[model samples]
Target: MTDFNRDALGPPAGLVATMRLLLVEDNARLAALVSDGLEQQGFAIDRYESIDGAEHAQTIAQYDLLLVDLGLPDGDGLDLIRAMRRRGNSTPILVLTARGGLDDRVAGLDAGADDYLVKPFQIPELAARCRALLRRPGNALDSVLTAGNIVLVTAERTIRVNGQAIEATPREVALLELLLRRSGHVVAKPALENALYSMEAEVTPNALEAIVSRLRKRLAAAASNVQIKTVHGVGYALFAPPAADE
Candidate 1:
């Protein structure tokens, strides 16, 4: 059995946002432990115990990562991994299972798993591995994101304006990262909601508005050249306003 009495691990360095992860594992205790552990490291986990449930969930929501176990109550997890790859899904997959044999590891990798971790592993190592995968070129968690005078370092989870650091809550930072990534493009409301909240969070109707308002105030106080524009009944966009001389 995996140890459940260990201390909670610290958040990994360079975590960009509250990445959403889908975890497929049958053992109830282990699933809960894994979910709790990853959530503490600044991830939002949506868990399922079977292949059918996992497949259904994916159709409804986009996930940043997939954590799958080889042995499941319904079928082998390898089949699920193989099917996803065949369908052209490139979301990073990390295998978590009791199968520690060399052959099992090779099979998992060949089936398109980016990484494999045997059962009874420490949460800290698992968190570290996830960050490593996200750090790869072209992945979502880029090292740094910039918009006009505002700079955000994903690895350090710090925001700066004109090289001076500014205080921001985690939610504010997450919103800023999303805006900076698609700067000048209108990001739909639903998309922003998904990036900012997890499946289990009880978000009120005006929660998104409230977050946007606070972030706007913070940016203005920092004297950032970039601005967030509400598209009025549609969505929001971030862009630098034209200079007065222009």
Candidate 2:
């Protein structure tokens, strides 16, 4: 619930296309192909080679969606899925195994997976399934979002710096919500544009820059360490994670 305000300005385009995905597979070639195809579909994918790899991924990586292959070199992929659930990881998991039987699919989903895919699936199908799974609208939460000294409360539409509520416009609030939603990962410009301005709304580039500049200032006021980095030819990311030197 990190408080971030959307700029009054948004991109002229209508499509908001950015998602973070986790991919687990043992087949090197297939994993590469799947990762590439999903990336082309506007998803940021993180891949792991085995159940053991996924087990570690569970600790360090955060994902909006998951693609898992049941056959792993180290052990049953199901075991990893089960382990993740046991640890209270609700990141959506979709089994992509060679097993096509109903019982296998049932077992996987019943084990707390959100979706399942059989082997030899088409790329388009995979993309479509992923979109469907990620379609859930996020609920505004009352819990505080703490990135160091910055805190945000989605329920009250309020933002505080070092425990002090700061004033902001509604536009800034929306922009900040998107940043918090996609925090810990890069959020491209096109996606921000769509979220801010509808496809029907027309916007100028200068306006876009002005809005982001305001957001950057607000974040700075919250903490000197806050940064909204611009990725040349890509988009912007509100990254508050510790710097490499730290």
Candidate 3:
């Protein structure tokens, strides 16, 4: 089963200063080098070794782009790309397969790849292509978000849990925005602290927890079952999304 979330369908954000990528190459050594280099360039990179990892990733996380190698132990990389598109996923994808023949390139594009690169290629070239893919429109999540049963628009500073609009304080909106972006992932305290205030911005103790409590109550009042959940010694996550049911 495939899950579709509002983040996937929402409008694209303005040009991102940083990006997150899903690298699906099985070779451990190459994957490390690529992942490390991308991290150095200030991009968050997650690597998976098989098609199952890719499938789990499609539902469990989000990506600005996918760097896939054609030859994998599980199955053809093109097959995965086609399946995601069939499910209405349109994140920009670039093929990094070992196959370079014209037919192979044709196959990747026909399978919905935006760009294709033969393996043994220059690392810089691969990075450059990834940058280009991010530049394309509709590759990022929507600027606003719908958390639990509530809809929050950052641009308008308004929140509507179930179609009835209400005012959300700037701080409240910020908190919801962070949780929504990382809908299914637990956000640790340190990260949430950082999100609340930039490195230079002043932050106070218990500020984050207090905000989460307020948001949780608001969501419950909206007839939503506390989508934001806390994990002991960990952090919080928006536990519900379009795919949460699946």
Candidate 4:
């Protein structure tokens, strides 16, 4: 049994922003390689080497896709799949395993995997599968968040202005995504800090402000239509694009 929510399709023709994915693989080397490859294609990944960590992550965060390996130290990946399905989690799951036999594939699908890929797969093939999975109706985050000519593809961690690519660091990209996601609304500074940095990060005072300042400069230099408007004591917001006449 195999499930295909969307047709077998390759990545989109042109460059587009991507979405987030949760990868549950116990092999450290493989996970690092896969994460790096996927990130190059614009996806943000949160990886877990054990089933327990992944299960805990599921309780707090939502992801566009799940890239899971079959075997884990704590338990079989099949159990996690079954639990997620039982809990009514419809997030698209793509199983990556060395188990290439027909029976293994059948069991994975029967247990509720959305797609399956045997190990020793190419990065291109994996990327294609990811694109296809996200293309399914309601299976992905908004592909593009735009404020006029400035577009933020949160999934791809890409920023573009009038169709021109503007280079962005990972932190800047993450910050841009947060602002763009709530473009018209205010995002508190504390929330932005949390979104940009993990709890354990040793942050200095005004560090967030410095990051925002740099980001603003980048946006301006690129002639982007969107602006990051700071509210002094309050948080920041992605201001609506200027009117044509203005």
Say which candidate scores most in lDDT: 1
In candidate 3, stretches whose alpha carbon ends up further than 4 angstroms from where it belongs are: 1-16, 136-246
Could you tell me how far off, in angstroms, the CA of residue 107 lies in candidate 1 after the best superposition?
A: 0.4
**TM-score per candidate, in order?**
0.52, 0.49, 0.49, 0.50
For candidate 4, write residues 117-190 as lDDT tens digits.
99999886898788778874233335676777877776677889888989887777778887876676789999
Which has the better lDDT: candidate 2, or candidate 4?
Answer: 4
Q: All predictions: root-mean-square deviation over Cα? A: 15.5, 15.7, 15.5, 15.5
Arrange candidates, best TM-score first.
1, 4, 2, 3
Candidate 4, position 22, lDDT: 90
Q: Write the per-residue lDDT of candidate 2 for residues 32-124, one digit (tens) a residue.
A: 888777665556677788776666665775678888888888888888888889988788788899999969989988888888888888887
Model 4 stretches astray by more than 4 angstroms: 1-17, 136-246
lDDT (Cα, tens digit) per residue for candidate 3, span 86-121: 998899999987788869888899999999988787
lDDT (Cα atoms) of all candidates against the true structure:
0.82, 0.70, 0.74, 0.80
Residue pairs that clash (backbone atoms under 3 angstroms), model 4? 18-155, 18-156, 19-155
Candidate 1 — what's its lDDT?
A: 0.82
**lDDT for each residue of candidate 1 in 1-246, tens digit (9 for 90 to 100):** 222211234335555455778889989888998889887777778889889878987898888889999898889999999999999999999999999997999999999999999989989788768866665434344668877888899878799998999998877788888787677788898988987776446778988899999989988998888989999998889996654522
How many pairs of residues collide in model 1? 1
lDDT of 4: 0.80
Q: Given candidate 4, what's the lDDT at residue 8?
A: 25
lDDT of 4 at 123: 88
Per-candidate count of clashing residue pairs (backbone under 3 Å): 1, 10, 1, 3
